[model samples]
Target: MRLTPRIVPLLLLAAALLGAAPAAPHPVEAQAPQASWSWPLEPRPAVVHPFDPPERPWLSGHRGVDLAASAGATVRAPAPGTVVFVGWVVDRPVVTIDHGDGLRSSFEPVDSPLALGVEVEKETPLGTLEPAEVGHCAPAACLHWGVRRGDEYVDPLQFVEDRRPSVLLPWAGPP
Candidate 1:
């Protein structure tokens, strides 16, 4: 009844108006820069389609995501960055990196032999994955994965992981 600090913000505003649910769960401030990044698709590939961006800027969302991956797999380099671009677009095969300050990612149908400035690091590979009738995850095979900074369109799974938004915490067990 006397925890001080103004009674701890009125007991956190009466536990947010009595909804009360928070035994621990805070961290979630990374737009990019916490463990850098990874997972261009290796032992961890299965999103199928997410990142639905587009509130304006021409509409038709789905900015990026769609992991699955199988046709040719490989496709690495989720961090270090350099290979500015690789090829194709209107029909598939993309690639593109440039992870400097303005961060970029892009990977599409991918087939890259690793040209165009070439630097890469994080995972390296950066090729393969272009079979399933050239992307769009037709019968399966995926790997769209896109991220940008200069033009916007973020949420490449918030850089490798921690998509956040699952805070239940409040049941110490022994009920």
Candidate 2:
């Protein structure tokens, strides 16, 4: 093909137009807020089951996904935010990070060293998974992580891409 001056601009314009087309919205984008976040687990493990069917006759469906990890594994923050809640829920330390713009991440059965109101970077260490100690979730330790926008829960994996920084657990490996 011989490239002429006139044709070159036209080709470039066509390429630009194609590239400018809006990307398709991610599955969770509609439900998620403007802020971005991600899973704290490294290597992006697959969810055993993303959604749990409603078990009760008058109840709703499962709100979050479960990541597979060994007990005492580290759990990191999925995004940059503030530690909104860090305390023992029935003796199992739970940590909640507020990633502003209405986005938030929550992890149960955490061994968090950060206190409430602490500002954390993305992938910062949140705590470790002590399954044997935490009665609510034991045997095989894993972080029961959840993402919330306002009050509604959304899937965390869909928001952040690649290895973004976040609150980290001591045991978490590189993503």
Q: Superposing every Cα of model 1 onto the true structure, what RMSD results?
A: 16.1
> Per-prediction count of colliding residue pairs?
0, 15
Sliding window of 10 residues with minimal summed lDDT for model 1:
26-35
What Cα-based lDDT does every candidate model obtain?
A: 0.82, 0.73
1-175 per-residue lDDT for model 1 (tens digits): 5587878998889889788664575554435444458788889887878898889969888888888978887889988979988998788779889898897889888898888898989998988987777446787778888888988889888787776565554455595
Tens digit per residue, CA lDDT, model 2, 73-152: 77888878999998877767789999899988888777788988999998888988667555323565666777788977
Top-lDDT candidate index = 1
lDDT of 2 at 28: 34
lDDT of 1: 0.82
Badly placed stretches (over 4 Å) of model 1 are 1-59, 62-69, 82-98, 106-123, 126-136, 154-175
Per-residue lDDT for 88 in model 2? 76
